[model samples]
Target: MTSMIRMFSLAVTAMLFGLCFAAPASAQATRTWISGVGDDVNPCSRTAPCKTWAGAISKTAAGGEIDCLDPGGFGSVTITKSITLDCAEGIGGAAGGILNSGVPGVTINDPNGGTTPTIKVTLRNLTIDGAGVTQGTYGVRFLSGKSLTLQNVSIMNQGTGSVPAVSFEPSAASVGATLHMTDVDIVNVQNQGVYITPVSGVAVSAFLNRVTITQAAIGFKVEAGGTATLIDSNLSNNGRALWTASGAATANLEGVTIAGSLEAAVFATNGTTIRLSNVGLYNNAFGIKTTGTGIVQSFGNNRLGPDAGSIGLPTATVTQK
Candidate 1:
């Protein structure tokens, strides 16, 4: 009888141990791998990495992660899902950085199949060099998305083909997207530094955090109902530094510097609401121009720079050709 009791006690102890000490079998997010020399058709495992950004982007699940086996050799990736490309070590190292300059850089492919793609990518600690190739336009184009967040990524030397440096072309209102750019430096765009063209959905907001846009046709063009927020940015050496057509844009400027424009520094029209906070403007022409009932409210720490022009009070609101 004592032996039987011992056996029962052992079985009970084993069950209790399994319940208290055993780890729950939880699944982890899957990761895909990419390399400068990889196969797009192969499995995206660490041993056999994928070839193109388009391939990895299409394969990666929304909540999954993708890591580059070595420094990535980019060839214009189109995103269609939610994935994180951990580019912490930088793309090409000291000799040369990742090239998105010629042909197509990062194209947003939506018309592929199924529903339109809404890609959420987090690119951290990577230098995306455009190599002064402006033919095919844009270093990074966020065409259609639910929302885009670019953190600590540098997009330089875009627009060889008279295309804007960065183009945010949304699909429709049902798929209205927002672009949140953090610490992005856009330089040497021929036509425009940042261009937003609406297809069906005209509502778009572009937020810039510590961004510098220089040597372009226009610094920022807010077309239709497009809105932009500039924070700690430098806009210099452009035709109409900031042009707002359709008077449908709303701009919030904070700690921004605008310099070197042939015409008005900030050309606003169509009842646009332009709010300035600690802003600085130094244009050879008029400081600010407002037409069609648009208003530039000089609020809180906003000051016209040393080379900035006067408002001309009541008469100078409208720009003269």
Candidate 2:
């Protein structure tokens, strides 16, 4: 009986030893810390988290990620890696917001090496405010990438000449890419809510998926040669709701509501082909205005009634959580 008990005890001890060493490696993800005035030169641990956003960007491994928790989510940084940086709110990182009312939110410069070796970056559940500050650069900018998705994010009150809340700038060596922005709220931006410009015939695409814009000088501006989609969205009190510059681009505005704009809510300039279905156009200016040789084709219901102004389309539906 004594011999059997000793053998069993030894087996249990061996098992526990194996678990202890393996546990740390399994949970060995890097946890970078942040202070109210954190900079990049510091060690990225909880106690020695990097200080500046630029600092954290340098430590992120190519395709690795780093989340920063601070009192102000400021600074300009370039991304060439597959990273998920959530300074405001997201899982696996910080869940509180520190974006001051008057500061730069984030500036994303694309890979300067001509080719971007990274994959996708998903930023969700954050608030970015550039309240009449300096030219805030951009809330988020992408030059070369496979995919980029922004969900449940807010970009409000950027400076007077700040770029767009979200911008996609394609490279000449780029094939094509997609930017999926869903459930985004942009207001009081001087330029645009979401902007995209393909590299002359580079064929990149931009999708303002489920975006809501209020009080923007220009709402969703699809520059020349960029194909864009505005689905299930609301643009109110803008200079122009959907501004298209190129005729080569196509805009499908379905289930959208535009009220009180300075100009035509939807302006299809150049040779742009704009399709509208079940869309509502309200007072202040022309609802669906197209200039030049651009074509505005409507197959869906445009007029619902005098009191009712809303296009009922499934793709244009937005349910806030």
What TM-score, over all chains together, does every model reach? 0.76, 0.76
lDDT score for residue 249 of model 1: 73
* Residue lDDT tens for model 1, 209-299: 8888887877788777678898998888777777776646777788888887767777778767677777777754777888878777665
Give the worst 10-residue stretch by lDDT in candidate 1: 312-321
Q: Report the lDDT tens digits of candidate 2 across residue range 39-112.
A: 55676656677765557666655555566565555445556656666655533355433253444455444564
Model 1's TM-score against the true structure: 0.76
Give per-model CA RMSD.
Answer: 8.1, 8.8
Clashing pairs in 1: 101-130, 134-159, 134-160, 134-161, 135-160, 135-161
